[model samples]
Target chain A: MNQAGYSEETMTNVRAEKVREVARLATRTGRARSGEFLAEGPQSVREAMALHLHNAGHGGQPVVRALYATEECLDRYPEFEEMAAKASGVRTRLVSAEVLSAMADTVTPQGIVATCLIPETSLEAVAGLNPRLVAVLCRVQDPGNAGTILRAAAAAGADAVVFTSGSVDIYNPKAVRSTVGSIFHLPVITNADFGHTITTLKAQGCTVLAADGYGAADLDVLQDDSAARRNENQDKAMLEEPRLESPTVWLFGNEGQGLEEAEMARADHRVAVPLYGKVESLNVGTAATVCLYASARAQRRNCT
Target chain B: MNQAGYSEETMTNVRAEKVREVARLATRTGRARSGEFLAEGPQSVREAMALHLHNAGHGGQPVVRALYATEECLDRYPEFEEMAAKASGVRTRLVSAEVLSAMADTVTPQGIVATCLIPETSLEAVAGLNPRLVAVLCRVQDPGNAGTILRAAAAAGADAVVFTSGSVDIYNPKAVRSTVGSIFHLPVITNADFGHTITTLKAQGCTVLAADGYGAADLDVLQDDSAARRNENQDKAMLEEPRLESPTVWLFGNEGQGLEEAEMARADHRVAVPLYGKVESLNVGTAATVCLYASARAQRRNCT
Candidate 1:
């Protein structure tokens, strides 16, 4: 063994079972069985590893099961080397480029991938915690869109994210890869029953707003009202029932069908991000980001 | 075609020259040689056809060269049938599902595809139009992110979108598909020289702001300052030179590298969308939506 302690013998066999097992995480059923999902690329791997360390330090279980990287990738990201030295129970392995590619879902995995143990977080657990803001996806089919919304929610400091039944798997490889490691950052409730979720959130005094294209309440006006309430002691609470500054849940619907009338009716208010130009409608992910950030800004501005 | 004037013997040949030609549009070189790009699915085709008719009314060229659709697609969208009748120079044909799939980039092109003339709009032309808002993508290589920014820019009522040299092709099939018909909503300046584009925008009195993660100016603070000035008469213009209400240009860079030091220096103000959570950073597309919407609200609020 070299004194440098960086490179172990690089695994070159492309058809090895270990490589195949890692590659299988790309599928829903595969991940479900293993209780693990993949986080791809340097940025995502870094986040996952960091979270693992943070969790480990708090006497919590380290979620990362294993780490895979090419020799070139290890040299490029030395921070990973430092983490690997300190990481407990993380099996760090150097793999050939072909093996690394075989183990990842993306065409370009950027030479690193990590498999993380999926934590079974429940809606009941989240509701009990008094989450200020939550992002809910109902039947959002696209993995990329789902991941984008999740990432935005995390960026906006959303307390929890909920995915109703029929929604894409949050652990789907494309979704996990797309998230860039946000899956490790917050509580995610998957395969949730929408009715129970709404009821629980309501019981907790949370205002649920549907992000609809044709919603009656404009998001801008609501934000202005929230800001006015913050800037000046306006008590416009009676005029605007579901204020953006209040503890809230944003319900986003499917890409093609959008929010069904029943789903729209369920929310306390149907809030729309206004279209200022000729663009007919907002992309679901785009609308989700705008809505999440709106609440984030409103809630933060009021607190400070 | 039958007496009903539909279903012209359903084109079944997947290898026909016409099919191959349409398929070639997916490649940049092929599109460049043909001077055309493809608009797939119902939404994009509908927008393209609408623009064609609008242009034809003004003695301008009809952008749509031809449309190929399946019988089922036609049955689904009768509006396409009506548009075909109204369109002057557009050729329409019906093809089998296999043929349609072979011709387009996406597997599910929703049974329809249209080839349209690519417009050559210059930065100089856009600059002369007294545009209040512009979204500039500098070397953004991801087609999806580029399209998201374009779509959001259109939604925010940004007058034009600019793609500086070294950026991904705005007309790439994936980019066009991701734009979701916003491609036809506004002017797009492609292959623009960064220096000239900046100079032109500045000459037109556009306050150039770079959307950066490490910028000095916080977006929320600027927004609040703008809103306070709007609600009350607190003009803190001296402190914040590039007000949100001003005719402005936002410069965004590559997803991973972000704005170059030189590029960031050129901007009059470096603005950041504050991240309020454990998530370290924002996705390029998500950040674009937030920034664009911020300007949209500010510009609209001030006017009305």
Candidate 2:
């Protein structure tokens, strides 16, 4: 093989104990016991490597514990090769297609997978940073929804994302895949007490906004009012009011039952994304994205 | 039985011909042959029923062809009773849990499923309505992404949603499920020629905007400029410019590969949803929702 650092050796045994252990990371109990998660597909593996490189000098531990890739995947995707070269600390192992399949949770693993230490962030650390925008997912069970929300938060420039204890495990392969590499972009705090997280954010001068379908404050009206205020003045104090544009933490709830009354009450305001048509409401993922972007746009305007 | 009009029948055999026929609608070929689709779970069934009732007098066909529910499901959900009462035209049948399971595509079928006629809308019909906002899904393959886009468009007050022929089947069960009952909210046109759709939309005085990651136009800047223009004047002509606030159709492409070059050329503007953080870009669903809502907000302000 002409490729440098590409292992010529191949693991052909699909039933090997090592391959089974890697596949077990797909389950919550397996992940808890191993303290590692699988980052499958080229996008996820690439991003994980990039984050490892970026955090190298910040006292962050090596995230990419090992990489398993097929020879064809390495040849077809040059980016994977580049990522492997960048993360020299990660152990690379060439595997057969069957071996890769045995280690992947998905029907098709895209020829690349990585074993990574589960990333952790503390709520107090997130709150201490005084983040201008944060996303809180409370009891959100769908891994896809949870991952997409994290992705949305990152794109919307949220400083952090905190998932309550009742939420899905962030390291779940399905959730990690849905993030589409955004999981490596910012701080994601998991398994935090919902009430304490909200209180901490509030103490950090953040206005906690609960997203609910039956909430009193309409999102459109809130945006309109904020736009009006922005048009009136560019003063820093005026722009920093505890409204949609201010330092905000958006609380999103579960797929089936949304935020309970107690959860909604923990927030400073309950905001509803208005439905102009007959559609009853937005899904948690779409609603969270809109709310995050609204704050992103407002905060950017305030800065200008 | 105390329940009025409730059938005291149960279908215990999962391999019954009726069960097999209902399960077939989960596939494209099955839906094509039967001219019907499955609306699974309570949310989808309820919305399908409401839309059926709403369109009853408008020369629309009977939408609900048949209803399959387990006895336990009917006993637990009173809304099912209400829907049954409202939809007297629908053939209601009681089935065993196993029979219902055999007929559902989801892992958990939520106890109720309805076979509904495929709702059809012509592009000409959509164009003739002079819709202020429409969402065009061009070759978007992900069923969940396609359905979420439909849901977002309806929530954003779009008059219609058009899916190009290359896109996933609108009747795909996952897409229908992801719509969360929003599928029946408005006119959804599928299998339309992409170029013809754009030209027709343009001829209707609608501005065609293609969402691209590499586009020159920034969404936030566009929103800010439109907001400024709206603050300056409320004149009808001023509001009708080819801007974010004007009559607009947002073109979103596939999950992996966005809009092609030729497709981008068809739009009046190619807008990029700004990424404030290190995240490479937004998913098609989140990006489309933000774009649709931006236009929704701008147009609503213009009207005021």
Candidate 3:
């Protein structure tokens, strides 16, 4: 026991039951039953530890439960040692490279993995927060796309990200890795009811916009119209339309099948990112990022 | 044979030598020696066939050399039959699902795959085309990121996309699959000298902007300044300031290591997308898409 309360013992057995359980976390059932998830790679683990330390100081529950790293990884990231020392409550243990590899989801784990509590928030709680910008992922199946959307939402200053019941599990190791630590930056609500969530957002005075391919409203045209209106009249009413620059909750659909007719109808406006070339359409991740950033830019412009 | 000249003979044996050769195409050496690449999934194969048909009518060599599909895939996409009929030079054959799986890079082959020529072009030819908008990927490693950048560039109406030496192969099966068939929409030049390519673009009067994490200029500030300038004065000289809306080439760096210092210095302007939240940075793919779309929207506004 150093200041961080890390154990001195080294866990070298790859076949140990503890290591096997950690490896099992790579599966969906393992995560659901255990109520825990693995954050692999140095970037994710570092961010998780940092967030844990921040929350601990504020008297919140520790997000990181256990930390495992090889000697080399520990040496590469000395800040991890400082974080572990500060966390006090987290179990920090040294493990062999092979053992760490077994616990990781990627082919190359970079020798560090952390077990974290699955951060969950209720749909009502999220809506009660009065978030100006929100991202709703409906029936999004791909883990990478889900993670990338979370990252984009965080970067664009979104307050929360909501994944409906049909969406991929945000705790999936691949999805968690894709977030590149953004999973810890903001509130992410999972297994949410799509209809109820949208209704709550609408009730809270957030304009709900559905991103679709054959949308009646074009994103470029919307932006141009907003800009033109702002230039023509500086009236508050004209500037306050629930359009690009207003408080918005964007609905992004599945990869293969976009938002269904009912889902699109639930939103205040269906907006399409205009495609100028022969390429059919943008991928979900890229399309969502573009839309979020467009709203971000518009809102920022209005502010200044 | 049907009017499309598709062979009636079905390749049911997955262990055949031809099947093994096709499997080898998943490697870089195989693609280098044969100068051919595999386009998997229905989206990729469909777009390849469409491009082949278009090129054939214009007296150019067919892009798709061979096509492989299951009977179910053919039945689902009858347009493929019409495309094959028009692409008289392409060799179309029916294959079993197992044979298609063995030839595909993904676990699920989507019942169709095609071998296509690498579509080579020279630096001189690219510059001579006087392209108004382009994307230059310098030393990017991830195939998925590379493919997404190509799709974003095409969606932004870029005239061409260039991959410098040391970047991942554009024809990597994973990269091709990620492109979702944008690989067939435009010319993608690989293995070019970055320094000379920049010089040529400069000589052709195209402003080159490098996307960097640390830069003196901010993207939003640039866009705002451009908008303000256009509003203040409608002069031709002001319009030609090589801002976001002008004819330009965007240089994106690798996933882990961003653009080299030298590469950033070579650009006429080094711009950073502003970070509004706690997330450290955006991934290369998402950042590139945002930058390209920003320029696309700006240019379109100026046009109207």
Candidate 4:
């Protein structure tokens, strides 16, 4: 057994017991206890290792905790040998297919898995944010929805994301998988008090926009203004744009029951994308993207 | 055995055999041979039934083939009971939890399952479509990716979708579930020839825009000309905005390899979304949504 108490031989073995335990990590309780979640496929594992290195204050080196592989994995990825060799600090374990399958969270293990801790970010780091744009998710239960929203927010240049009570865990393995590693690139806060978050943003002089299906404000009107601002000096123009000057918070609600009446009432503006289709509404993740991009377009138009 | 070698009594008696059969339906060959694919959850089942009704020209009433349910399902959904009461032609088979589990495609069966035939649409129905927008996916292997793209295409007012050769089977249970009934709303053609599709679209003068992450044509730039046109019309004495026109085909490619160089080279235009974040690229689904909406937004801007 190595210092971690997992026998080098046992850790490298594929057993039913290990597979069951690894699959159980899909549940919240199992992940919390183990301080680990499953990340599969080469892209996801690479992102995990990259995030570790990024957080370790290194530019391009790998800062992985543990790297596991099978003979098939090595055969499929000859390049990985050189890459792993460079990360000397990272512990390596060679396991069989049985072990790989047992430790895999996905139906197909792709012959590799890695263990890494979720990096903790302090509230103080995000509190001083002069965010021109932000994403706010309230009671969104599905981890996929929350993760996709975080990804969209980051892509749209939102400075931070705040998840009010009742939302899924940001670190949920499914959520992490959905974000495609954007989780490590942005400030994501969870289990925050809705009232407090709103108050803090309002105090910061930010505009709070609630995205409702029947929102009164038209999305086109915002997009038109933002496009105009982008043509001028961005730094000076940012302050002039109504959407940008007012640090904005976009609130997306639970999958089943959208934003609460009180929560919608608290926002300075309510906006919606026009729907002409048979379906009643867009999924929360899709809606967040449209809304965030609309705000981004609006901010750009007005700033210039 | 009474009709079709599957009598009510025989089905009731052979619970294990039925489950084995249902589980086998996960594969394309099984689904095709049985003339049915699995659909569960009250929402999806409802959608499936509605799809059946529309196909039968019953003016919005479903023409179900069979319904396997427990008392729990009937009790929880009185609407299901009421619908069952009205539909005498459809078969309803009361089942036990064990029976339903065998029939379920999901990890946790919603205590109900249904078997329905895949709907068919012809090329003539979509040819020369004016207000129609369609998503053409080529070789997208991931069921989730296919599903997400379908859902986004529907939201952006697509009239239909077509899956080219090498794409994941649209009837895959996970793909159907991910679509969230968009499958029912849109006409989908699968296993199509690319050369033939491109020829038909060209005959209709349907602009084909392929999405590539490295394309020189900025997606925002494509919108710029249209946005300029809108401003021109408003000025009266100014100019007319250039419109890409609606009913265009947006081609998205495989998840990992993305659009093939040859395929993209033949496109009318290649567009790429700007990325400022650490994440290398957006998920296939998210990327499709952005491109689809950009096109929709451009057309709407010009029309108005």
Candidate 5:
């Protein structure tokens, strides 16, 4: 190896304990400590570096502490060098494929992994958009389900996603990997007080609607013009004389408990996907996608 | 322990090996021999059992096998007991949690899993659907992606899904898990010749549309009747005759390579999803959902 090539002599400590520890960080608890999670593959690393540069300009701390790039990543993507060069505040360490294997989360690492800090956004900042549609996750435990919901929310044009109590860390490595970079685009807020959040949205003249497995609000009925007009009138009466349009928040509940009775009661409307199979309910992710898109489709049609 | 509790005793050769082997079957080779892949959760198990019953009757293997319901599963829902009793040739056995754990695929199994022989579906049988819309997967390897695509196809009303060379096993436990039981409702065919399949669809006057990142056909063209008509004359001239508007087989390729040039060239139309991110492509599942739904939406509007 060339002396100047990646400065192997100056490489940071790859202590046995540290390797064992980071491997353990594969779990959710370890990831929360550093306020950082792992992102693998060339595409993910590139996006993290770009986001790091963007956020670093703000008072936000540098998110990516390490960039593990393999020979193939360097050779195949010359842009990796460009990104690494621009990430001035972030540490960029070059590791061999063998070392890379230890740090990488996926079975196939795609020759790169970057440690990225979870980005935090405030509810007020999100509300500033006066977003017509939003998604709320309650006690969603599965990272894949949570990540898929986030991806669906973004694709369906939901203004933001808020995680209520007991949901998995939005920054879990599996969740991040599952999002396939959708995490970079959406406004995600976690650990919210569900009741207060609903109240606050109501104060802002937002209609808080929770998706219930069993509920009276027929989504199909919501599509009807007569029913929508009735909803609009009801919204106007609930708030004030001025009648500021009420934004809608679509709440999804935990996998097992689903929506709490209290939460369901708080919702202006409770709705479900009409299902036709021996299987009673769709998977949480699928349900969220179908619901979010249904809302989006409805809103788009109504607006036009 | 009761003698009748477990059909096979704990001391038998099958006990320890069964648990260890189920754990080891994470690899592909092991799954092939078991002839039975795991399906997790009450929902997955329910779907698998129904499919098993349906296929058993269809294939003339109508000998209903023993029904092994774990104690926990029975405790959770007593309703299963009544249903289990009514089914002919079904002998119910109660398995301990330990034995159930050995058979589970998840770290925290939903406390329910069922074993069923893979349902066999021939390509000719599915093609007989006169499938107005079919999803064709060529060399897609990820179990999650394959499963999600199948789920999406079912949701979007695709008549069937055909998997070609290099595709993951649709019957793999993880793949089945990912499908969310959509596998039971839809027709899925695996291990078909890619070239022959394409030609077969083409001969039937079915448009073989391939999804490509650099597709010439604008996706919006399908949404508007005028645009579709405008392109129809040009397309007809190239084909030497006007198409009578038959069914369509939409091809999705490997996650990494996408559709090959030769495959795309054979396509009656090539369509691409417009993306707005540094990441080049959507996850295969998301991409397939957007495309399939786009076509379905178009079809719905045209029908009305």
Candidate 6:
């Protein structure tokens, strides 16, 4: 074993105990047992290394448990080599392509895989940011949808993303891949208590809105009203409406059933994205993107 | 043969010539040769049937050449039976689950499949709509992205969607599946001439905007500027910005490489959605959703 306690000789056995241990992280139970999940492909691994280096530089807990890469990948992307060497306590090892593939969930691992510690975050951590915009996923099932929304939340500059207890695991390998490295750019809280999460964010001056298709209020109207108010058009009647310009928490629901009656009831208002055509409903990711960006846009008038 | 030229008896043979013909529609060459494409599952077939019935009633060319469903599916979704019988020349037949499985591209066909006429649309058809918003995909390689964008465009009330010559076939089975029945909701032009498409739309008084990450203009700024103009803020120096409220065509490029330099040059402005965080860029579908919805919201103040 090297200083970081990984094999010195390149891992050549596809069925080695260490390889099997890494492969096991693909499963939920395996992840729970090991407290780690796999991040495959160069893009994901590159971001993982950046986070590891950042944590190492700061006095934060290191995120990478073990990183396995093929020689060809190291040759192609030299930055990974430089970052790995700089990040302390990361178990880095060179492995053959076959060994890396066996340890990855994707058919093509693209020559790199990392076992990363599952992040733990609390509502205090999120509220500490004094977030202007936040996204909450309540029972959103698909891993891809969760990842897509997380990535969108990050891109739209949401302070944090919270997934309710029944929602898909953001640390799932496929979900991590779907993030395309945006997973490292923002804070994410998984398996959160749905009711308490909302109430807490609300206490911190966040307007909690549920994204519902059958809602009475149209999102465009609210946006227009917000703009009109921002322009100092004092209509006054619509002043009681939920303000998009304020700090906000958007609750997105499952793909098929949408928000439960209880879920909708929990929100200050059930907001719907305008469907100008005959679409039954907007895909959750698309709806979330429009909603989060609306808040981002409404809140950024001063900054822009 | 029945009135529609298919056997009246139920199709039970999984390997029959007719089954092979239907299965072949999953491929591009087969779709081109037969001028038919397969739409699997009930939601998609339901939409196809609605279009077929509408066309048949209007003396337009009937869209569905054949409709196949398992007995269990028919019992579950009786609307298919009712619509199939109503549409003239629909050659509906009940197939066993095994036979339906053999005919579908998806692992689970969810009980119905339709082989429909390949829609042929032109610049004239789109121009005739007096469109205010249009989405143009230029060499966008992913079928899922193409389909998702189409669905988003339709939902955003885009008048039509245009696929440049090298882009994915909107009629491809995977692409059609991704549309989730939105494929039948709006006019789509495939294999379009990129340069001519931009020029013609421009000639028709449409502003063409290329969505580029490295764009000179920020979309949020333009949106803010448009709102300011609407509020009658006469800052005459800022009048030169592209207006998002005007009738416009948005050109989105490939998944890997965005719009080419020449393609960007063909547009009135290369507009970038403001990236609020550290994400390198937005996913094409996410970007398209934001851009189209921005245009839709800007253009709809008068209507809503």
Best by lDDT: 1
lDDT of 3 by residue, A69-121 (tens): 98788888888888888887899899999999888889888989999998756
For candidate 5, what is the DockQ? Answer: 0.17
Alpha carbon lDDT of residue A280, candidate 5? Answer: 54
Writing each residue's lDDT as its tens digit, candidate 1 over A186-211 gives 99999999999999999999999999
lDDT of 4 by residue, B194-293 (tens): 8787778767767788888887777666666667656656455333221354457888999878989878866787778766466678777777888888
Ranked by DockQ, top first: 1, 2, 6, 3, 4, 5
Q: Estimate, for each residue in B152-269, the C-alpha lDDT of model 3 and write its tens digit.
A: 8888888899999999998999899889999999888899899999999999988999998786778877776566555556464464345887788899998999999999989998
Q: What is the TM-score of each candidate against the true structure?
A: 0.96, 0.95, 0.96, 0.82, 0.79, 0.94
Candidate 5 residue pairs in backbone clash: none
Tens digits of lDDT, candidate 1, B84-132: 8888588888999999999999989999999999996788889889999
Tens digit of per-residue lDDT, candidate 4, span A1-304: 2323122563544545555666666777877887666666676777776666555555543335666777677668765565566555666677777777777666676888776554454334565776678788999998877888888887777888888887898777778777876776777777788988888777777899898888877666566655644544446554332353356888888887899999999998888866645666777887888778666655544544
Q: Determine the backbone clash count of candidate 2.
A: 0
Query: What are the interface RMSDs of all the models?
Result: 0.7, 1.0, 1.3, 2.0, 6.0, 0.9
List, residue by residue over A56-120, the lDDT tens digit for candidate 6.
87887678888898888887987877777777578889999889888999999999988999877
Residue pairs of candidate 2 with colliding backbone atoms: none
Candidate 4 residue A31 C-alpha distance from true site, Å: 4.9
> lDDT, candidate 4, residue A179?
84
lDDT (tens digit, per residue) of candidate 5 on A133-192: 788898898888798788778777778889997889877778888777777766788888
lDDT of 4 at B68: 76
Better of 3 and 6 by TM-score: 3
* For model 5 chain A, the run of ten residues with the poorest summed lDDT: A237-246
Model 2, span A1-304: residue lDDT tens: 5455566568899999999999999999999998899999988888898878777857686788899999899888878778777677877888999999999998889999999988766888887787999999999999989999999999999999998998999889999999988888888888989878888888898898999999888887777667767788756335433478889999999988999889998888888998877888789998998899989988887656
Contacts from the true interface found in each model, as a fraction, amount to: 0.83, 0.81, 0.70, 0.30, 0.04, 0.73
Docking class of 1: high
CAPRI grade of model 2: medium
